[model samples]
Target: MTGSGHISAFSARRAALFALLSGAFLACLALLVSPPPVPEMKSSAIPPPLRADRQVEPSFVHHFGRKHDEATWFKSDFYYPNSGHPAWQADLIHFKKNRVELEVRRRKVAYKNIAGAEYQRRGFYHYGRYEVVMRAAPGSGTVSAMFTHTHGQFGDPHDEIDIEFLGKDLTKMHANYFTNGREHGGIYIPLGFDASKEVHLYAFEWEPGAIRWYVDDRLVHTATPADMAIPQAPGRLMVHLWSGTRDQFNWHGEPTFRNGARARFYCLSYQAAGDDTEQCSDSYTPRKYRR
Candidate 1:
C-alpha cells in the first residue's frame, strides 16, 4: 500500500509538470504565429521660406523658371550640361570641342529635389543671341529639353528666354519668351528639315524686341516686337539642359522599371538671346510677339 501511494504521488506530480510544459509550449507557438504591429510613419520636416521682396536680389537674378536640379534636369552628352550653373561659374555647356556644336541625349530621370539655384541660372547676366541645337527623343509624350530661365518666379518679374525640344514629335521644338511670371509666352515650330536622325542647329537672333527662331541657320518662327514681357529693367541669362518625367508632358506614359530604355536630344548649337525682348521703336513694323 505504501509503495502504491508513492507511485500515485509520482504520477500526479508528472501530470502537473506535463500540464505546465504543454501550456508554455502552446503560448510560445501562439507568439510565433502572430505578426508584429507596424510602426506609424513620420512626416518630413519643412524648410523655412525665403523672404519676398528680397527674393529678386542680385545674388539670384537669372535662372530657369522651370524647377529642376542639376542632376534631375540635365545629364551629360559630350559637353552639353542641363539646367543652370552657379553665380561665379561660366556655364559653357554650349560649345562642343570649343565650337558651337549642340548635340546630346535627353531622357527623363526621377529624383526628389530639383533646386535650380546653384548650377548657373541665378545671377546677373545679360546679352547676345541664344540658341539650342539638338534632336528630339525617339519616343512620344516628352523627350528631353534645354532651357534659359530667369529669376522672375522667385524674385521680381525679370526676363526669361528658353529654347526647348520635345520628344513628342521629332520634327518640332518649343520656344518660350517671358519677363516675370506675368508675361506668359511660347511657340511650337515644325522643323522643315529632319532633326530626328542627324544633328541640326536651333538658333535664335535676340535683338531688341525681336526674338527670332531659326532651324539649321534658316529663319522659321519669329517672336517680333510687341508689348509683351521681356526686357526687364536689368536682367540675366541662363544656360541649362535637363529631362522631365512627369505625366503632364510625358506622352510615352510614365516610365517604369520594366520598359526598355530610350533617350532624346543632341544639342548642336547654343547662342545667348539678348535685349530683344523690349518693346521696339514705333518706326519699325516689328514682327508680332503676341496676338
Candidate 2:
C-alpha cells in the first residue's frame, strides 16, 4: 500500500480509540459526580377503621346543682318507690351523704314512643363518650338501663345510646346505640367490676364519629360511626336510669321486666360544651362541680 494509504488507516484506528475512551471516561464521571445512593425510604403505619378512641383515665368535671337562671335541666321525671304499677308520681329522697336517691320501681306505665321525647322541655341527651359508675339490683325478669342518648323531643331524626345492666350479674354491661330509631349498635363487655355486688365505674365515650364503652378502667367495647350516627349535631343530652321497660331492648334478647329493682346510687360526669367549641371537655360530680 502507498504511504498515504497507511497513514489514513492509522488515523481511522486512532479516531475509533478516542471515541471509545471518551465513552468510558463519561461513565466513570457519572459514577463519581451523581448524588449518593438514596437509602430506601421507610413509611410509617396507620391504624384501622371503626375503632373507638383509646381508653382515657378517670376524671371529674364540675357539676352544680339546679340553677334557676340556666335553661338546661336534669331532673328525674319519674320515681316509683314500691312494687306497684309504675307511675310518674314517685318522690325523690335525699340521702345523708348529700347524694340524691330516687326509688325506681318495676310497674306498668305508659311512656311516649317518640325518640324525640323530652324531659321538662329541656332536651336531655348525651353524644360524647360516657361512663356510669353504679351498683345495680340483682335478679331475672329485671332489666336496668342508663341512657345517654338523643330522643325525638327536640326535633326529628332521633338517636339513642344506652348502657344497660340486667338482673343478678352486674359484672356484664351491655351497650347499645340507635340512629333514627333503629338498632344500629350492640356490645357485651365484662365490667371486671360488679353492678349488684359493688359500685364500680361504667363508662362509654361517644366521640365525634365513634363510641368507646368502659368499665372502671377497662375498655370494654369500641364502636364506629359506620355502625351508628352518634355525636349528632344539635342533639339533646340525657342521663336516665331505669329497672324495667316495655321497649325494644326486651324483644331484642335483652333481659326485661325489672321487678322492684333499684339503681342503688349513681353519678354522671361530663365536659360542658365550651365557648370556643361545640363539644364538651369537663367532668361532672353531682352537686359538687361548677362551670
Candidate 3:
C-alpha cells in the first residue's frame, strides 16, 4: 500500500516474466539444434558366426612342382622315420611339373639296414581344413603319409593327426590322432579304389569339437571328443616315405625294395580356421602357441 512496496511488487512481477520467456527460448533453441534419436540395432541384425557347412575356397595353395627349394617350405628330418631306420635328405625330395615326389630306397649307411627320407612344413598350423591330392607309393613294407604333428616340449602335449597309406595295399589307408604324447582314435578305412593308381583328394576337417576325414570329398570318418582326446596344440604339416622293420610288418608288411617306393603329391591346399579367405603369412618357423 506504500509507494516503495508498490514499486517492489512491480519489479518482482517483471523479473518473473523475463525469466519465463528466457527459459522457453532456450528450450525451443535446444529442440531446433538437437539431433534425432537413432534406433538401436538388434542382436539378430548382426552377422552370425561362421558355419562349417560350406567348403571355402582355398587361399593357401601348394603345387609341388614349383621352383622353390625344399628348405624354403619344409624341414628335412634326420631322425628315424617311425619304426624304420632312414636318414632324411633334402635332395631326395623333388618338385616337378604338378607333382612332388618322396622316394624311399635301400642304402648301406653305417650299421643301419634301411634308409629313407622325410620332410615337414616349416610353419605351424592351427585349426584348419587340410587337403592333399596324392597317390600313395606301392611296395611291401613301405609307408607313405601326410600328417600334422607337434612335439611335446615345455610340458606341452604332443599332438598328431595322420593319414597314412601302407605300401602293401594302396586300397586301404589309416587315420589316427594323438594327444599328450599318447596315441588314440585310430581307424583303418578301406578305400574302394587303388590309391597308388591315381591321385585323390584326401582331407581332414579339424574343428573344436569334431574331426572329420574325407577321401575325394566323401566323408569317410568322423572323430568326436567322446572318442578320444582332441589335439589342442598347433603343429607342422608333414609327409614322408619309409620302410618299417620286421616287428612292424603286421601294419606295413615286408619291405620289398625291388623297385623302390615313391609317393607323389600333385597339390596341397589349406583353409585356415575354416575360413578359406584367410592367407597364410607365417614364417618358415612359425610362432609356437602353448595350450
Candidate 4:
C-alpha cells in the first residue's frame, strides 16, 4: 500500500510540470502570431506632398477696429523695423476710434534713436493684390509704407515690393521693387493731392511676371520682368512708420519731429491669384489726381 501511494504522488508531480510547460509554450505562440502596433507619426515628419492638401493660404480683409487683431497681425518690436535705423516700440502703436495709429517720436535723450511702430501680417503670401486705406504720416524724413518683403527667412532671396511715402513730399507716391537686396530704381507718381491729409486706397497687384500699382483703383504704374526680375519669393505684408537719418536727405529728407508724427490705417485687404472675391470696400473715395 505504501509503494502504490508513492507512485501516484510521483505521477501527479510529473503531470503538473507538463501543464506548466504547455501554458508557457501557448503564450510564446500567441506572441509570435500577433501583429505589432503602428508607431505614431509626428506632424514634422510628414513630407510636403502628403501635407499639401492640408495647407491653406491666408486670404482675407482685415478691418482695423478698436483693437488690432492679434490672430491676424503682429506688432513688431524689433530694433530696426523694416531694416530702417529707427527702433520699434510696441507701445507706439495704438488702436482707437476704429483705426490703427502708428506713432513715431524723436527721443530727446538719444535724438538719433527714433521710436517707431510697425505691424505685419502673420501669414506669408504669394502673388496677390495687396491694398491699404491709410493716411500717410506727414513729417520731413518720416516714411509711412505698406509693402511685401522677404528677408531670405525661408531659403529665398531678399525680395520686396513697396508703396512708400516720403513725408518730404506727400503729393508723390513712390513705387519700388527689389530682388536679392538690390533696388530696381523706383518711380514717383504725382498724386496731385496730399496723402497725409485724407485716407486713400493704395494697392499693388503682384503677378508671376508683372507688377502693377494703383491709387484708388486707377492704374498708376506697371512693371514687367523686362523692367526687372519679378520677385518670386513669398513674403509678409507690412506697414510701418519710421524716420530716416540726415544721410538719406537726398531720398527721405531730414526728419524734423517738432511734434510727434502718426499714420492712421483703416483697412488692409489681400486677394490671392485666381481669386475674384472683393474682400473689402474702400472707406473713402480717393481724391481725383490733377496730373
Candidate 5:
C-alpha cells in the first residue's frame, strides 16, 4: 500500500508538470500569432503643441498624367544612412502612363541597402484636408505611405499624420500621428478590400480640435484632442514606398524581393482650413461611413 501511494503521488506530480508546460507552450504560440500591440499615448511623452494658424486660400491639386510640376513637387534624391534600410533614389520615381510610380527595388549590396522612391510637395501646409488617390504595394516587408511630415524643420518639433499600408497585410490600413517625435495615436482599420488590388481614395482632415481619417470618403476613424494633443506644426505632403529591415519583421513581415514592388499615385489634393471647395474632384463615389 505504501508503494502504491508513492506511485500515485509521483504520477500526479508528473501530470501537473505536464499541464504547466502545455499552458506555457500555448501562450508562446499565441504571442507569435497575435498582432503587435498598438502603442499607448503617454502624457509625459507629449510635447507642447505648436501654433498653426489657418492659411488663407491655400489649395492645390495635381493629377499625375505625364509629369509632376517641378515648381511645386520635388522628387526626393536623398537617403538616410542611419535608417539601415532602403535609400531614396530619384530614378526610382517614375511619371509615366498617367500615374506616379514609386518603386522599391532590392539591391545587391552590403548591409541590406535597397532603392526606394519618395515625392514631396514644396513648402509646408497648415490645418487642412489632404487627399490621395492611390494603390498600395503588395509584398512582405514593404510600406506604402501617404503622410504629412515636418521633421523638426527650422527647429519646429517633429509632427506628422500618417496613412500607411504594411505590405504584409494590405487589407489593414494603419493610421498614426506623432507630436514632437513621440507617437500618440496608432490604429489599424480593417479595410474590407485589399488596398493593393485597386486604387482607392484616402484622406484626412486635420483641424485644431480633431483629426478625421476617411477611406473612399467614408469616415473611418476620428481622433480628438481628448485622445491626445492634435498635431499643430505645418508639414509637407509626401508619399514613399520603402522596405523594412529584418529586425522589423515582427511589425512588417520579412521582405521577399524576387519581383520588387511599386505603389501608384493617381492624384493628390489639399484644401486649407475654411476653404469652401476642394481643389479638384475625382469620379470615385463617396461611401457611407462605417465603424
Candidate 6:
C-alpha cells in the first residue's frame, strides 16, 4: 500500500475509536446521576423513626370539639366516618394476633348514610416516621390508605400526607401530599409484587422541609419543599376502607363489591415529633387537646 493511503486509514480508525470511547463515558456519567431503581430484595427491613425535636410548631390549634358518646368517640384507633358515611363503628375494626383488620362487609340494612369504614388516630403527629405493615384489599372501586390529614371549613386550606393503595391494581401504590388546600406532589410507585398477597412495610419520613417514601425499607421516592408543598399543621393519622364513585377526586374507579372488601393491617407504628413511638389505638379525650 502507498504511504498516504496507509496514513489515511490509520487516522480514520483512531477517530472511530475515540467516538466510541466518548459515548461510553457519557452513558456512565448519566447512570451515576440517576436515582437508583427500587431494589428487589427477598424481604425489606423497615427503618426506625427519627428521634429529633420538632423544628416548627403546629400551624393549627387542635381542639377536641363536641364529643361523642364514651363508647364510640375519639378512641385512639377509631375515627368517625364522615363524607356522609356514618355506619362505621369500632365493631368493624378488629385487632387479633397483633394485626388490625378494617373489614367492610355487605351491611344487611343499607342505610342511606352508611357506606364504608374509616379510622383516624386521636392526636396529631407533626414530623417523624409513619409506618405500617399492611396488605391492601382486592376489589375495584375500593381504596386502602394509611395517611395523615387535616381539613377546615369551606374555602380553608388543608394539609395531608398519604400512602394509598387502589384495589384496582395491587402491584402499584400512590403517594401524595397537600399544603394549604392545594394539591402539590404525587407519584405512582410500582411495588414489584402483588401488595394484596402478603404484608409489606410501607413508610414515609416526614420532616420540616422534606418527605421521603419507602417500601419494605427501600427508599423509593423523595420530595423537598422546593419541589412540592409540605404540610405544616399537626395532623391525625388515618386508615380508610371506603369505596368511591367515578367522580371523587381520590377516585380509584367505579364502586364494585359483590360480597364487600376488607383491608388487613399487620401493624401501624408512629414515631412522632418528640421521638415518641406508639401502637395506634382508639382512646382520646378531645377536651384535653382543645386549644
Candidate 5, overall lDDT?
Answer: 0.77
Residue 273, model 6: lDDT of 54
lDDT of 3 by residue, 37-84 (tens): 534434432222122232222347676675755343653634432334
Q: How many backbone clashes are present in model 1?
A: 44
| TM-score per candidate | 0.45, 0.54, 0.70, 0.75, 0.75, 0.62
lDDT agreement of model 1 with the native: 0.41
In candidate 1, how many Å is residue 251 off? 8.1
Candidate 2 per-residue lDDT, tens place, 1-291, comes to 999999999999999999999999999999998855533312211111111332222223322233321243434334323322134322332232422333445433344211111122133333444445455656543445656544343234556667777664566777887777777744766766666667666666666678777765567677786665664543444333343334544522343434344554345555332322221123323333211
Clash-forming residue pairs, model 4: none
Better of 5 and 6 by lDDT: 5
Residue range 10-32, candidate 5, lDDT tens digits: 99999999999999999999999
Task: Please say which candidate is ahead in TM-score: 2 or 4.
Answer: 4
Instruction: Mark the regions of model 4 whose C-alpha exceeds 4 Å error after superposition.
Output: 1-56, 81-83, 108-112, 153-155, 282-291
- Flag the better candidate by TM-score, 3 or 6: 3
Q: For every model in order, what is the number of clashing pairs?
A: 44, 31, 1, 0, 0, 8
Candidate 4 lDDT over 152-254, as tens digits, reads 4334578999998998898999999998888888699999899988788899999999999998889999999888899987776789998866667778877
Cα lDDT of candidate 6 equals: 0.63
For residues 18-76, what per-residue lDDT tens digits would candidate 6 score against the true structure?
Answer: 99999999999989987555333122121111222323322221212233324222323
